[model samples]
Target: MRLAPLDGGEDAETKPLWQRLGWMVAIWLVSVTALGAVAYLLRLWLA
Candidate 1:
């Protein structure tokens, strides 16, 4: 089962450094925020 299909058209290396880094940072922030929210909810439920 393939989770992500490989696209033959777009080249990753062609993207600018800022755009690549921006996506990385954005994904990281979103993941962290989601984790924190889940942890808070779990704490409240356990308390």
Candidate 2:
């Protein structure tokens, strides 16, 4: 069977590539900050 359709799908979003990339970077930064906070807390608990 064929994979993706040649034409844009009904459910596919129309947002631009740069907007998507910016959102990805913002999410990554938030995730990193959360991990750093957890690590700091764990270190304090162990000490």
Candidate 3:
């Protein structure tokens, strides 16, 4: 298999609009999951 050149920002800049959106969604999901877990643990400890 051939590798795409490490043209800085080229892949990111040329990605379809949805690709950027998909990344944002994935990040948000991770953030929410982490925050929820922390809050649950804190509540469990305080209670």
Candidate 4:
């Protein structure tokens, strides 16, 4: 016997606007942190 999953593979558009904004903010935060770490390391090595 097979059971269907809830929401059934819905499209991203179905998510509320706030949820999308949350994901964008999280990704941007991660990117900024990574860049800052890289810049700091380079400055330390070059100095």
Candidate 5:
């Protein structure tokens, strides 16, 4: 059987390197901010 690309398709490869990196950084920032907010709220609840 054949396997699909990890990124879902060729669209990710078609984009420029900087654009891809920018998207990754943006996603990482959003994820970190969300986790931090959750942790802060949990701390407030437990304290």
Candidate 6:
């Protein structure tokens, strides 16, 4: 598959609302979990 450059933001209105929200929530959860892991490791290293 040929990869193309981002063509700006895709129109949100074109996608189903549930699909967009699901992606948002999934990404948010992943980011939060990664941050928590980093904080935990730092705390352990500093103790």
Best by lDDT: 5
Of models 1 and 5, which has the larger lDDT? 5
Kindly list the per-residue Cα lDDT of model 1 for residues 1-43, writing each as its tens digit.
Answer: 6445566336788899899999999999999999999999999
The residue-by-residue lDDT of candidate 2 on 1-47, one tens digit each, is: 65677456543468777887999999999999999999999999999
Which runs in model 3 stand beyond 4 Å of their true positions?
1-7
The 10 consecutive residues of candidate 4 with the worst lDDT sum are: 1-10
Instruction: Say which prediction, candidate 3 or candidate 6, comes out ahead on lDDT.
Output: 3
Task: Give TM-scores for every candidate, taking all chains together and pairing residue i with residue i.
Answer: 0.77, 0.68, 0.75, 0.75, 0.75, 0.72
Q: Best TM-score goes to which candidate?
A: 1
lDDT of 4 by residue, 1-47 (tens): 64567445576768998998999999999999999999999999999
lDDT of each: 0.90, 0.86, 0.91, 0.89, 0.92, 0.88
lDDT of each residue in 1-47, candidate 5, tens digit only: 65766556678779999999999999999999999999999999999
Regions more than 4 Å wrong, model 6: 1-11
Runs with alpha carbons beyond 4 Å of true place in candidate 1: 1-10
Clashes (backbone N, CA, C under 3 Å), per candidate, total 0, 0, 0, 0, 0, 0
Per-residue CA lDDT of candidate 6, range 1-47, in tens? 63455443467668999999999999999999999999999999999
Candidate 5, pairs of clashing residues: none
Q: How much lDDT does candidate 4 score?
A: 0.89
Q: After superposition, how far is residue 22 of candidate 1 from its true place, in Å?
A: 0.3
Model 1 has a clash total of 0
Give the Å shift of residue 30 in candidate 3. 0.5
Error of 2 at 46 (Å): 0.6
